[model samples]
Target: MNENKKPTLEICLTPDAVSFIDLTGKIAVIVDIFRATSCMVAGLASGVTHVVPVASVEDALSYKSEGYVTAGERNGEKVEGFDIGNSPFEHMEQEFKKIVMTTTNGTQAIEAVKNTAEQVVIAAFLNLKAVTSYLKSQNKDVVIVCAGWKSRFNAEDSLFAGALALKLKGDFWWEGDEILFSTHSYSSVKNNLSKILKHSSHYKRLKEHGVENDMDFCLEIDKFKNVPILKGNILENLAK
Candidate 1:
């Protein structure tokens, strides 16, 4: 393959940064390192039937009456009167037939790429390997879109994107600038694993709620082998 013509990998810090990447013909990987992607990996790996990601709390609530189990967080707390919070532990009780999940950043990021990628695959530290394997198999130009904290940049998500970028670096050519295409090595991602808990509102909130372990779980690399791909309104695993 010609060096200039090799398939490329482009990482974006947020969805707003690259709103023009046509999602119809390419794979879009969404990473919300704080917890949504982490919770997604745990939920799917634990056999929760299907996870339906919604952009708004109202949408999630509406789905609740339709037999959809609700799992959501606003700011960082579980939605009031909801079945589960954004934590993976909350969804481990049983196979969630249909979980309406929402969050401040992750959910919106998923929604942002709803019409962009040919398909949206959820990525986190837990499923990084799974996501990378799936992307390599597809052999298409890929975009790693990070769902940063609120609208501002966050280190954890960037590190996760970096990890993916590092994996995709050799096989796929990078299309964006060096900063987007390159990141600290996987070792760096591993080193900063604990920092996600130390530096983010999600960690602080979960710590306050006595769920510090969730952050540790989220930061672990390749703990899960499942890749949650956004299908229609629900997230389903791609057979590896």
Candidate 2:
């Protein structure tokens, strides 16, 4: 480990594993590729003012009481009594002033590291280039935390993490158990991202619920130039 070299990159394949990692000075990029972080990135990129990611439906509802637009999902379906579901396409269809959202994995991952990490940002394929660029500029050790399905590992998030790992390899030394797997995953599906996503567990679940369009929207690479940064408890457009 060269002390003068750029900071190393690591990957935590699931939120449940986050506690074991020391995130004190690292930049944590939360990846929930199936939809949560994707929707957050889309919401901000499509002009949503701020995104408040909550750990549960109760929290989202609480914010809704304060006039926030509530959106979330449970098991890949929209939660009852909410304004919308976890769909980037739905978010892109209209502008929202503020969005309060919760999901099975994504939001939970965000909450897990909010206090420990030096900075937290939401990443998806839509903002891949932007996120990598920001990370490069900061030159900080990065941990790509995948909000796996129900605290378990999932391919989509790991693939995105691997893509980031590959993109940053030139500037950062890759570290962690899943780094090689992630990079391999990225290389295997780089040209056929959507096709590979369609075969993912969460993607199939979303399809059963008739939200394949949302899945399609989420798999698009670099669809937006914006990155969503978590400031305190809110996610604001990094470009702002």
Candidate 3:
């Protein structure tokens, strides 16, 4: 296939992948929509400083004692001994710097394909336009891996992926049908974003946790001009 004809568009709705990404050949967009990526984007935009993605809560704790503000979640709750949990609002603090973060699903999904992809990027609804712009500039095949809750599928991640797909489909050819949830969900949200997440488990989780406002914040698009891409073990702000 020619450059335009190359089979380059693919969306992995869940982090469970049989093959790891070959970063030298493809760009991997990692989505951990139920707030890890959201928090990262928020932290950066809020001027919290650098974010370091870790594989475990223990790893984050190790960094905490070293002055890195620690953040993560397990089963949607903040870890018992961390300075912070996986919430964007929490990172808004001025003390935030070199955040070491892990989460049940988000971080694992990131670690899952970190070694395979040529470039690993973190994505969230908060920086949708920034991510879409970067994806447009790359000629390589694109794979969007949604960090679902545990090994199970969640509506929010796919919905965020759908938004990316809908915008990307006009420019890149897609590979699978199931991953199209992101595109479809994007459309649904566009039509009714306020009500789009009313029934989602993520929304329920937030409401139960008394953080409904953060959910509203996450659903907003293009709030920041900066996109965070993983470079080595840390997240770097991509140029606007």
The order by descending TM-score is: 2, 3, 1
Write model 2 residue lDDT over 29-122, tens digit each, in one string: 9999888999988888777889899888888899866889999899988999999998887776565779999998999999999999999989
1-240, model 1: which lDDT tens digit per residue? 236766777777876775756566777788887688888888888877788998888888898678988887888788898888988777766757578899989989988887767878999988888788888888777878888877666777777787788887788887666345337543454665685348666567568877777777787888889988887888987765
Q: Residue 83's C-alpha lDDT in candidate 1?
A: 87
**Under the 3 Å rule for N, CA and C atoms, how many clashes does model 2 have?**
0
Say which prediction, candidate 1 or candidate 2, comes out ahead on TM-score: 2
- Ranking according to lDDT, highest score first: 2, 3, 1
- What's model 3's lDDT at 35? 84
The local distance difference test score of each candidate is 0.78, 0.88, 0.80
- The residue pairs found clashing in candidate 3 are 21-116, 23-116, 23-117, 23-118, 24-118, 161-182, 162-182, 162-183
Candidates 1 and 3 compared by TM-score, better number: 3
RMSD of each: 2.4, 1.4, 2.0
Candidate 2 colliding pairs? none
Q: Give the TM-score comparing model 1 with the true structure, all chains together.
A: 0.90
